[model samples]
Target: MEYKYNKNEKTAYQKGYRVTKEGIVIGKKKNPVGWLHTNGYRRFKIRDHEGKNRNVGVHRLQAYQKYGEKLYQEGYMVRHLDNDCTNNHYDNIDIGTASQNAHDVESERRKERAIHASSFIKKHNHEEVKAFHEKYGSYKKTMEHFNISSKGTLSYILNKES
Candidate 1:
């Protein structure tokens, strides 16, 4: 839950460091090999004296320190482009907004939906959605006759124009 760090706890082996809390050792210190054992699950999660999670693996910490302020200002989270969540190397990380971050996971699907919805909104609402449909006949004919994108964002445009 919490790892207590102190000056005296610093050791000769950089990774061979363990923090404690309430006089109890949280986890065994790890050696360099053991630290990067290629195991998917890490044996220990480095915690701060207060129990907050702060990844202190030299690489991760350096990344956080380097881009923390800039990311905070843009309201973006630093993401690992490699899709390896554990790899915090500076080269692999990028700053992204919440929507942009979500895009990383399902960008293609979202893009397709945006493009289609834009036309559907403009066409259907003008066609079958109103008396205009009687004059226009059908939605597809209306779409072919006009060429609107999606039907979803029509309200937004109408509101802005008003």
Candidate 2:
């Protein structure tokens, strides 16, 4: 079944239970504070369905950490070894800690930066980097787009439309 996006709300019915995109009412499926989601429907998390927050993707990773093993399709991070999130093939998915996952992402970012930097340096006639700010499209937009916590990484990439 196709999954739909659901906004979160302060559901009063349960402490941790929340609605999901599949219309299930999952509650505390797995967690100390009891992470909740709608039952039957495994499309979304309670927080996503009920919480009115813009930074949804920030903590969404945690839900995978909290309930990945218990949830269907979403189990084991469903990582795309090739770096595509939508590629849910079983061969691509694997269980890993958030920090570890972040490490993988960082490694990919570094590789991408290296490759892109080389191209930029060569194609742009060595005038690729212009004080960092201009090339990265401002620090705020860069961080938000990358879902990054550390602004310390000296990595760079061309935010191109693939």
Candidate 3:
């Protein structure tokens, strides 16, 4: 079955719990307190206010706590500045559009590619790579010759596509 997004109020009601600004989830009625359990991604289970158990990313919770409720809305996403999901500190979390988040991820990938390319260039001269490409007449063959794993980086170096 498809899962639903965690609604703060709804989850609190269904789980008989209330999450405080301090990131403490207190249960109500006969439910237990401090029942915050993390999934591998540091998400916690909450029976949504609709009575459906759902896992909420802790970073979102932390953002909610720090920025007040309603921090997340449709088309909005929570981003980790250090790209570490587990680091849910208030200062580390912020809101951004889905595209902005995607750009951040792409920027990180570009940085990695640049690093790999620099190392590859240091190991093999530009003339050598150009000759290898010319001899093979195939980007894939040139990549195989250079043992380069990122095709994007290879394209950037050979085709000047960035």
- For lDDT, the strongest prediction is 3
Evaluate all candidate structures by whole-model CA lDDT and list the values in order.
Answer: 0.42, 0.39, 0.60
- Please give, for residues 1-162, the per-residue lDDT of candidate 2 as tens digits: 432333232231234644233223344654222223233112333334445432222123333333442323321333334454433334444554444465556666756655654453444522333335466767666545444334333243333322
Candidate 2 contains a number of clashing pairs equal to: 17
lDDT of 1 at 131: 49
The lDDT-based order of candidates, best leading, equals 3, 1, 2
Better of 2 and 3 by lDDT: 3
Candidate 2 local Cα displacement, residue 115, angstroms? 12
Candidate 1 accuracy as lDDT: 0.42
Model 2, position 139: C-alpha lDDT score:
61
Arrange candidates by TM-score, descending. Answer: 3, 1, 2
Candidate 1: tens digits of C-alpha lDDT, residues 1-162? 222342222321133443221111234433331144354422234545665644333333333345544534445555655555556455655777665555555556555565556555554454333444357656555445445443323323233332
Q: Per-residue lDDT for 124 in model 3? A: 48
lDDT of 3: 0.60
What's the lDDT for candidate 2? 0.39
TM-score of each: 0.34, 0.26, 0.47
